[model samples]
Target: MRLLLVTLVCLVGLAPALASDLLIVTEEFPPYNYQEDGKAKGMSVEVVEAVLDEIGEEAEFVFYPWARSYLTAQNRKNTLIFSIGRIPEREDLFDWVGVIAPFNTSFYKLASNGAIEIGTLDDAKHYSVGVSVKDVIYQYLKGQNFTNLKVVGEDILNIRKLAHGRLDLIAFDEASFAHRVAQEELEPLLFRQVYRLEDLSGDLYMAFNKDSDPDLVERFRSGLRTIKENGRYDEILMRYQLMN
Candidate 1:
């Protein structure tokens, strides 16, 4: 009985350490959540980090491709995902912490490509469009029956494809286009937004796997609310120009 009691005490002591093992996961969706110089940095990342600090918690951020990050956050316990599009299709998949940033998705084309035009969503079907695999935009467009999509694992590829005239248009968020453009050394004036996906233009969020501890999730939610009240959240957004 004494041995069993000691074992129980040890397990109880380890609980706090285990609880702090939150895996912060995200993809390279810039100005919002991205990695730089081996450290996590960006608007949404800062917001999440502030929440962690406000609540006196710490975690490691892992950067992956969108599909891998999405899958890990969807199925792994204690994994927190950020800058994820909170769509109806994903409403019940995870326990949402709160909105962390505003997201704006759009279809962009080469400014010089005056020959191709998209008057309606359906008009985009007539030409080849490039999309990143498992991105929210790709999922939404795929559901809407867009067969002309050229799927790629990385969104940065789409930028090159459209630039080289291999794709008529590429779907991207406004911030991502600008970030990738600068990262790729492409001229910003060369691309233009042909259409804004107003439906996907909404709040990005941080969420935990559905099976996460209710208390932990609630604590994070409270931390987020506290930071927003204390103005840290707004400062991060203003820095990124995501003020909405």
Candidate 2:
């Protein structure tokens, strides 16, 4: 009984520390989240940092593959994943923080591939679609009942496959697709946006594990509101415009 009492006392004393500490996870999504010269640096990183600062909280960030990050955020206590789309399948899985960045997903085909055309979401069904494995786009397509999808580990691989004529259509977020194309010095005009997934067009958010303290999430939200009101949010966005 004495040992039990001591344990409870220790835990009570450690509660605030555990509540304020967080393990933030993110993927290498350029302009939003990525590594620069061996350091975690990006627009989302800056925004998250600013909000944590305002809320008097501290977090350590680690970059992981999206699938791993997503899984971790789903299962680990106090784990947060940033720049994730809040899809319906994930609606109640995590405590969502508001818009960290904008996301516009679309189906793209090689401009040279005049044979392929997608006028609507239904029209895309007949053709082969390339998607990143375990990505929100993949989930979205699966939800839409798309069967002819070639899932790759990296979205960049889909770009390569699309260019090589391995896919009839590829799904990608507009900003990320453009960034990757530019990174590879590929001609952007080579790809044409055949159709935009209107339903998938929404702002990305920072999401915490479902088991996280609700008060902590609210505090972060408050901090975010403060930053937006103070113009720091817009400032961060503008500072990263060059990357976008």
Which candidate number maximizes TM-score? 1
lDDT of each: 0.82, 0.80
Among all windows of ten consecutive residues in candidate 1, which has the lowest summed lDDT? 1-10
Candidate 2's C-alpha lDDT? Answer: 0.80
How many pairs of residues collide in each model? 0, 0
Could you tell me the TM-score of candidate 2?
A: 0.88
Per-model TM-score versus the true fold: 0.90, 0.88
Mark the regions of model 1 whose C-alpha exceeds 4 Å error after superposition: 1-19
Model 2 RMSD to the real structure? Answer: 8.3
